[model samples]
Target: MLFADDPGFPGLPDDFIQRGPAGIEAAAAALEHGKPIADIQQFACLPPFRRAGKILCVGLNFAAHAKEAGMATPDYPTVFARFNSGLVGHGQPLIRPRSSDQFDYESELAFIIGRRARYVSEESALDHVAGYSILNDGSIRDVQLRTPQWTIGKNFDGTGGFGPDFITADELPPGCEGLRMQGRHNGDVVQDTSLSDMIFGVKKLVAILSAAMTLEPGDVVATGTPSGVGLSFKPPRFLKPGDIFEVEIEKIGVLRNPVVAEA
Candidate 1:
């Protein structure tokens, strides 16, 4: 089921299962509505969350990505938290923060929490998932490499470009393995890969994170990017004013954004 936070809290379209206000409430509501989910193409997309309490991001979740960066595969999941102030919508301008000279894009899949959860078992983690959305976890490669700490380079206002539409977790049909994630500049494809390469799947990520922190409704966890980041390329491809970047997650939707000079 899909819900929009537009001016009107519109009802779930005829094609969607109705989910209610609270994450689980909304899911239950969706099921009760007995409405077939409308084609997501029919209705406009909404931000994953109007506001989220926290946005946790994972790094190097893909082995190929780790190798591309000249780093060894992670000993364990590399986890970090992003500030909510960075969230932005699809097609929005991703301001190039003046504090850094290197900016890059990392295409990822993000999961929205349906309810409060702590120490949730992997078998039951899907129950707490509200749905899934796309994320362009933009980063400032310079700062990321400057210090051991990567937070400063990873989270910047307008850098978190996400959401054209979110589909309920249930709608993701079974046997739909290996999602293709790609990035484009103008019309050329720069990065492409299959989700099958992810070292840690969504279930395991939530299980590990839940053990360390309580994930509440609206919390988001970005699965992580594949190889082909600007910094990983020769001569390094970085975002500049007037440039446009588009991220596409197959079966979900596409998110397009233009680069702009930050004040």
Candidate 2:
């Protein structure tokens, strides 16, 4: 619910996800009766959480993706860190830094935590998930590979595309398996795969990550992308200015963004 709709609240607060399950349910109930915006489409859709907590991104969690990238199947999830500064809302422009022309795309399954969980068991991990969404997880090839550390290359402002909607966890199958995920560049399908193909599914990721650190409400765990990433092609099809990239997951609507050169 918008703060403008409720004067009891002063200004806007950025911690919607931190509201916990009960608060979230109350808000959802309130929004159900609120007057709908006649022109919501014209409004830029923000990422579901606005500012989600720790973005624990997993890498090489897809077997085919690891194979295509010439990496072996990881016995443990290759976790990485991502900041919200690099995220762009749906229909927003994803800046392609002029510093490099090797920008790439990754379409992955991302989920939000609904509970504060630590030392959670894999069998009980689903109870901690609030909802599921999509992550394009954009990458800067040369820079990403420059070092064993992917932080610098993975974080270019406006490269990542997030949101359009946040489908409640109950809406999807357990662990989001059986769903198809695809990535497109300017309407051309580049990557295609099934969610069941992930090396580390949602349950495992939640249990494993939370075991190391407390997984609080709103933390986003991106479950890695499949094969067919730009770098896997004979001649990489890196993104360029004027391009339109999309990440579409079955059951979850598509998230689209336009590409523009950094000024």
Candidate 3:
């Protein structure tokens, strides 16, 4: 979606999924023949798409991340929720909250569900995916570890970096497997791993999550991050003002954001 005065699909409603996959295909065809859309750099990016509902996140789905965090890789995926208010799009700033100085970054691949699904099986879970995007699951380390529950630390306003664009599933391999995932801090490569390293892949996550609740179109599921978060460092290098963080997933695209202290 192009971010402009009006923002998003010109003729359609802001919620692109109202018309479903066929609508997206039609929009693609129109864009090919119609006048060009503005270059993304010309405008402020919003999350590849907006989901007014659930934003489910997976934790420690990467073995290395679990190891670095000093937690056992769970038999089931570690799940958490992030409010939409916490997210900003490409070129936006990730606010380092004043409540905590231990801000951290987790690079992850997130997928949007295109269809309503409940009690789905792993074999059919991928069918629910409409598209995929990148997310910097930004965290406030101190608050995140304050209690057994992580929602508070994770939901800090403007901390989550989401999107540049949503790449439809057709443009990616099934379940987005084998892709490379990387995170950079101020242009320095800090985290790098293969999507294959994820302990619970997309299909399994979908199956597990859907069994518990319905996943609707536009609902997002972030599939967790590989190691190299700020908190994983020996001295714990937390994010500070002026820091630029990036999350890049091969085939999906890159999500870049600058860090700014909360005013």
Candidate 4:
């Protein structure tokens, strides 16, 4: 069930996305009562929420990625936070910050939390997930590797571009292992990997995170990206001004952005 956040009813036009949790339930209940649902394709895809309370992300969750970067797999998830200001629409532009020598991409699968959770068990952690979306956790490589802290490199404004729309939990197939995550710049593939390579997976990350901090409804958690980033390429294939970034995930969808210098 796709839920769009369009605020107006607008005569229930075909494909009109139902807004709000109540609106989504009402639409489902209406279908049970034999009422029509606006055509699926007619509804415009909207972000899972206007703004998430927190955007938490995991680092080096993929074994291959750790190996590629010559770091040992973390004994525990390496967590970090990104400011909401970094967020951009799925099709939006990613304005590169000035004074940064290197910019790179990290394609990740991000999930939304539906309920407030604290110290949840790993076995039951997935129950809190509302849905999934595609997120490009774009980073500034030079700054990230320069300091022990990765935040300054990964959380710049317009770096967290995501969403064509959210794919509700019920709608997505279980066992995310085989999902394909690919990134391209100017029509050339740069990063390609499978979700199966993730070392921690969603369950463990969520359980561990919730145990440390409360995860509220609409909160976001990105599972981490695989290897093949520009930083890893020979001579380093960093993004330049006016470059197009296209990130695609098999089911969740694709998010495309153009690179531009900060104004």
Question: What C-alpha lDDT do the candidate models reach, one value each?
Answer: 0.76, 0.85, 0.86, 0.75
RMSD to native for every prediction? Answer: 4.7, 2.2, 2.3, 5.0
Worst 10 residues of 3 by lDDT: 1-10
- Predict model 2's lDDT versus the native: 0.85
Best-to-worst ranking by lDDT: 3, 2, 1, 4
The residue ranges of model 3 lying beyond 4 angstroms of the native Cα positions read 1-14, 34-43
Worst 10 residues of 4 by lDDT: 9-18
TM-score of each: 0.83, 0.93, 0.93, 0.84
Candidate 2: which pairs clash?
none
| Model 3 Cα lDDT, one tens digit per residue, 1-263 | 33234333444323656567877776676556555656664456777666558899999998888998899988998999998899999999999988889999999999988878899999998888888989999999899999999999999999999988788899998988999988999999999999988899999999999989998888899999888999878888889999999888998778889999999
List pairs with backbone clashes in candidate 4: 15-42, 15-43
Candidate 2 deviant stretches above 4 angstroms:
1-3, 6-14, 36-43
Task: Report the alpha-carbon TM-score of model 2 versus the true structure.
Answer: 0.93
- Model 1 scores a C-alpha lDDT of 0.76
Over 83-180, each residue of candidate 1 has an lDDT whose tens digit, in order, gives 76776777678889998768888888888776667998879877777677888899988887888888988878887688776766767732123778
Task: Point out where model 4 deviates above 4 Å.
Answer: 1-24, 27-48
Clash counts for the predictions, in order: 12, 0, 0, 2
